[model samples]
Target: MTSRDTDATTDATTDAAAREHATATTAATGPAATAADAPVTISYEEIDGARIAVVSLNRPAKLNGLTMAMLRGLDDAAATLRRDRDLRGVIFAGAGNSFCAGLDFGSVLKKPMDIVKAFAPNPLAGDGANLFQRVCWEWRRLPAPVIAVVHGHCYGGGVQLALGADFRVTAADARWSVLEAKWGLIPDMSGARTLADHVGAEQARWLTMTGRELSGAEAVEVGLATETTESLDDAHSRARETLRELMGRSPDQLAATKSLFNHAWRSPRATFRAERFEQAKLLLSENAARARTAAMKKTPPNFVRRGTWAFGAKKK
Candidate 1:
C-alpha cells in the first residue's frame, strides 16, 4: 500500500478452469498463487498509472457467482484498498461474459457451516458489518469512488454488489435483476440501503419483491446504471475516462464529495454539519494548499497523497 507499483494481491480461492483463463499481472510479478487460493475468485490490479484499483471477480464459468470464499476475498480486497492512501478510484468488474450471476445457491446450500459462520454475531460489532454485508458496504465506505462495470447477467447479490459502487456502467444488452425473490429471500447484503439511493423507494420495492430483470438501458432510465453503452468495451472506456479525470483532482475532495451525497438522504442536518466539518479539514490539508497554489499559478496541481480516513470519524 505504501507504493502503487505493487501488483494485485491474491487472497481468494480459484478453480483450475478459472485460473487457466484468468491472467493477473502486477508490477512486482507476484509468485504463483496456490490452488488453495481456487476459483481465483477475486483480485485487484492497478490501472491508469496506478491510480485506479481494478477489482475483478474471476469465476467466469459460473458467471462469477458468489461463494463464501469469494465474499471473504472481497472483504480482504476492500481492507487492502482502505489502507491505500494513493488510490484515486476503483473499478469493480467480473471475468468472462457476466458480471455475476448471483450467489451459488447449490454450493451454499451444501455448506451450512459457511452460512452459520457468515451470520455469527460479533461481540463488538465493529462498524456493524458482517461478512455478507461487508462485501458490498466496503466499497461504499472507501475514500475513493468505486465504479461498477456491468455486463451479461447481474442478479441478486451481484446487483447489490454493484449498488455498493459510486457509479455503475453497463453494456446495452446486459441483463440485471433482483433475483432473490425466486430464492425466497430478501437482499440482506446491504442492497436495501443502496438500492434506494439509485431508484425511488417504490421501484426498489417492486424490483426486490417481484425479482424482475431489466436491460442496461432500462437500468439507466431507472437510475440503476449511471450510463449504458453499445458494448462492454465502450463501458470500460468510459470508466477509464472517468478515472483519468478524477485522478487529476485532490483525493480528499473526491472522498468528501462522495460523503456528501451518500449521507444526503439519511439526515439533512447531519449532512450539512458534515459539509462544514469536511471542508474545514480539507482547507487545512497539505494537498488542498498545493491545489490552491497551483490554481493561482494556472498549473495542474501536484497534490499530496491522502492518508486513510474511516467513515463517520469525528473531525477535529
Candidate 2:
C-alpha cells in the first residue's frame, strides 16, 4: 500500500473510534448531559479596593449538579484564582435556585475514562490530591479566604465543597446532607479531612453513615456551617461583611492565620511552632508595619499586595 493510503486508513480508524466514544457517551448519559456545556462563571467584584472573586456554578436547571466538565471547570477556576495576589476573597455560590444538588452520576459515569482520571492522584501536587479532591481542597490552598454562600439543596459533593471553604454562610432554609451514604458510598472528595475540623468524630460518622439532612440552623449547631442567616440574601451580605472585616487586616497576616489554623490544628507543638514562625514573618512584613501605623492613627491601612508563601509547608 502507498504511504498516503496508509495514513488515510489510520486517520479513518481514529475518526471511527472518536465517533464510537461519543455515541456511547450520549446513549449512556442522555440529552441532559449536554447541560455540562454551560461554563462555571467567574466574575470579579471590586469591594473597597479589594478584588473579590465570585465563582457561580452555572447548571441551574440541574440544581448545579456536578458533571465531569463542571468539576474540571471548578478546578480550573480555583487554579486561576490562586495566582491572583490581589484577590481578597472568593465567594462560592450557585446559579438559579439551588446551591448544588451534588454529583450528577449519570453525566459523569457516561465518561468512564474521565472518572478514572479524576480519581488518580496528581504527581505534581504536594498534597496528593486528585481531580475530585482538588475541586474542594484547592480553595483551602488559596491565600485569600473563601466563603461558601449556601442556599437550597447542598448534598454529597456539594457539602464537601462547602466544607473546603474557610467559612460557610448558609441560608436558614437551606438543606445540607452527606448524601453519599444513600448511594452506598463514603464522602471521598476531601470531606473526610475538612469535616473533622468542624465536627467531632461521632457527629461526622453519624452524618456520613446515615446521610441525614440538616437544616442551616442545625448545621451551625453541629458546627457544619459558620453561621446561618434568615435568608439567602442575608447569607450573601453576611459573607461580604466578613470579607470586609478580613480585608481590613494585613493580607499577609490573614494568609498566615489561615495557614496556621489549617496546618497546626490539634497539635500543641506544631501549633506553637507555626505561631512563632508566622509571627516572625508577619512582624517583618510591610503590611504588618502598615497595620501598626493605621491602628495608632485610627485610620484604614493601605497595605501592599500579598506575597508568595510556601503552601502546605511542613512543620519542623
For candidate 2, the lDDT comes to 0.77
Best by lDDT: 2
Q: What is the per-residue lDDT of model 2 for residues 132-236, given as tens digits with 9 covering 90 to 100?
A: 899998998888999998988888888999998999999999999998888788888888888787898889999989889999999999999999999877888
Q: Residue 257: error of model 2 in Å?
A: 1.0
lDDT scores in order: 0.74, 0.77
Which 10-residue window of candidate 2 scores lowest in summed lDDT?
Answer: 1-10
Off by over 4 Å in 2: 1-37, 265-269, 308-316
RMSD in Å for model 1: 8.0
Over all chains combined, what TM-score does candidate 1 have? 0.83
TM-scores for all predictions: 0.83, 0.83
Tell me how many residue pairs clash in candidate 2: 0
- lDDT by residue for model 1 over 91-172, one digit each (tens)? 7887677787788765676788888888664557665766787788889889998989898888888898999999998999
